[model samples]
Target: MLRRALTNQITRQQFRFYRVNRSNTVINFVPQQEAWVVERFGKFHCVLDPGISVLFPIVDKIAYAHNLKEVAQDIPSQTAVTMDNVTVSMDGVLFYRVVDPYKASYGVENYGYAMQQLAQTTMRAEIGHLPLDRIFSERAQLNAKIVQVINDSTVKAWGIESLRYEILEKGDIHLPQSVMQAMQGQATAERKKRASILESEGERQGAINLAQGQRESIILKSEAEKMEQINKAVGEAEAIKAKATAVAQSIQMISEAIKHENAQKAISLLVADKYMDAFSNLAQKGTTLMLPTSVHDPSSMIAQAINIFDTLTTKRKDMKSIEASNEDKKPEPEK
Candidate 1:
């Protein structure tokens, strides 16, 4: 009975120890930005979050530890052929983060490396679709397209969240000497074409400005001539107005003076004076002169001059009477 009892006690102690060992396994404090994949007998059991955790000692084991942090990887330079058949080498970097640790561990082998290769291959394929010049001008678009492609291909398989892919540099494209010479010639021709275009534009603008200036000058000259003509017309009109006014005043003074009793004697005096002046002018200015047989016949010359003056006066009175009659016969403007 004592030996059986001791064996029962030993069996009880072993069972308790086994139970403790099986249920008590402590995982040390995990970083806040890290996670661990837990597996039971090589199969997925649960995901271990941050902080200490306890699990069944023999059945549950930490399968994989993953860092939930951002990572940057450099892509090595690789040669790619463009659509133009130009071979160019390029290098870049990629930024990614692990979203799901279980998938990161089990989805693909070497997630970081697989992503790098994917990025390279995708970039090459993208490069092959574009011309050489387009590759340079559309670098940002190219990087974005590469990132999208890599993410699309790797998100489910590699569990990697591709944030960005940046192309750092592209090496000089290796080309045949003939291609290089052709490129150089093409560059020279393009530069010359642009320069000629600018020069022609400048000349065209200058011609336009010169023509505009000449047009303005012509307009100004014509305006000055128009003003001069206007001023000359005004001056001539004023001179004619003054002459008419003087003639009217002289005619009025002659008509008023003709009522005096000495008017006939005044007329005879005026005629004799005019005859003397004419004789003096003829003797001084004429190349030839005719002398009357009776140069002393002053009375006869006076009588002839009086007769001509009277005939002119009579004609003037007749013209005045005709003008008055015509004015009376015309129709008047309506009031």
Candidate 2:
């Protein structure tokens, strides 16, 4: 083998060596440093950081040794979930810091592709359980749930966490406006029925309360009237008792005074006035004083009549006697 001056590659000199001589010199290359994989930078090439440097440059065919840890950077934190086997394309961003460098590097062939496959599979499983309505309407919420599910299994082995998600495609629940109107009508009918029931209950309760109030008013009024009647009766009884006591006292005083002749004579003068009043009342009522023909004396007739009237109307005579006693209190004529 012929080697160039600077590079380890075979130059045109090696070609000329092969053309001139079929078999001339046998040569082998002895590298000074370990081989490493390199990617182009602005002006220089830098090795990718992982558990160790990967894709070391070698002399044979160019072999790109991929570290799962370095490639997993493209895997986003957000995962996409398809609804009921529906296709969806979405983009997301992930924030990740390598925790287990060794596992990220050597756990899988391509960590990004593995994570994407895992996310896709998890999305399918999660969205398969939901209907089109939920998948389209609650896409973000379902994505979070699916992300959590995926995280449970992946984060431990893959050293990645699902941060957030976005949905790019959707399916339709496809409810018609006529169906919505029907639902609204049902709700309105239910509300109206409830309102009617409540109003009827209120009216019934109001009537009951009004009736109870009227009954109470009537009872109170009756009680008040009874109390008033009782008070009036008590007042009348007290007045009557007082008047009887006064009359009894006056009669007792007159009886004591009548022990003497002078008192009797004074009492007789009172009787004369009482006789005049009685005659006046008898005349007004068309009553006649009938003199006894056997007695033939006006005074005797009066005394007989008084005795007879007292026997016939005892209560009336009792009042007349009280009136006569009261007349005794008036001034008499000259002695």
lDDT of each: 0.79, 0.53
lDDT of 1 by residue, 67-184 (tens): 7788888887789989999877888899998888778878975676566678889988999999988887888899899989888877887678999988875452355577678879
* Clashes within 3 Å, all models in order: 0, 5
lDDT of 2 at 159: 54
Worst 10 residues of 2 by lDDT: 17-26
User: If scored against the real structure, what TM-score would every candidate get?
Assistant: 0.66, 0.39
Candidate that scores best on TM-score: 1
Could you tell me how far off, in angstroms, the CA of residue 254 lies in candidate 1 after the best superposition? 5.0
Root-mean-square deviation of Cα positions for candidate 2 versus the true structure, in angstroms: 18.4
